[model samples]
Target: MEKIKLLLTQYQEAILYIVFGGLTMLVNIIAFWLAFQAWHMNSSVSYLFAWFWSIFFAYLTNRTWVFHSTAHDLKTVINEIFQFLVARIATAVIGFVIFYFGVNLLKQDAQIWNIIQNIFVIISNFALSKLVIFKKKA
Candidate 1:
């Protein structure tokens, strides 16, 4: 029991990050499905729409829960938001490329490619958040 508690305490941040990240992915999947399947939007448009929502959700949850960001000042908060968006935008572009090539060029299933691209995005986003956007100040 003590060992389990200690491990959980040590890795709580990572565990919370995965939990929030999974929720963010659910948002993305639902958004994409609605746009693509229900609204009959183009693949690229649906993907971009989903990206927007997921990023919005990710920013909120990641700042509040995952990293416990402490930037209270207006300037610092703005800076963090800007940095987070930039990092997400970079990942979005990479995800788009993967989706495009995998689904469009390679004739793979869109659903499969979406999952694949998101896995990549989640890993990269975690790295960016930990190393750059929400790095703890010394």
Candidate 2:
């Protein structure tokens, strides 16, 4: 138990971020699929929906779990969202272009490439969320 606890704490923050990211990505993927396939939305519309989904979930999970900022409420969350978007607009634009090209244009069947692109977005998302959205304890 003690050893387990030690190991858990050692990787807790990283593990939480990873899990949260995966879940958030799941939200984005589902939204994308629904918008594109089910609702018959255009690629651009589907992409926009997915983008906003990712952004919202990224802010939410990162703030509540990764950063553990219990002090902030809805107003703070909104302000942080604006800041996060502003700082990440460039990174996310790049990420979206890469992801969209790979998934929609290239039609990448290789899971590796898709995963790699998603990792880039996740890393970029984490940086933005940490520095701008829900800053970690100082």
TM-scores for every predicted model: 0.75, 0.70
Superposed by TM-score, candidate 2 places the C-alpha of residue 38 at a distance from the truth, in angstroms, of 1.5
Which 10-residue span in candidate 2 carries the lowest summed lDDT? 129-138
Question: Each prediction's Cα RMSD?
Answer: 3.5, 4.2
Alpha-carbon deviation at 85 in model 1, angstroms: 1.7
Count of steric clashes across candidates, in order: 0, 0
Q: List clashing residue pairs in candidate 2.
A: none
lDDT of 1 by residue, 1-138 (tens): 999999999998789999998899899999999999999999999999998998899899999999989889999999999999999889989999999999999999999999999889888989899888999999
Candidate 2, overall lDDT? 0.77
The per-residue C-alpha lDDT of model 1 at residue 78 equals 94
Clashing pairs in 1: none
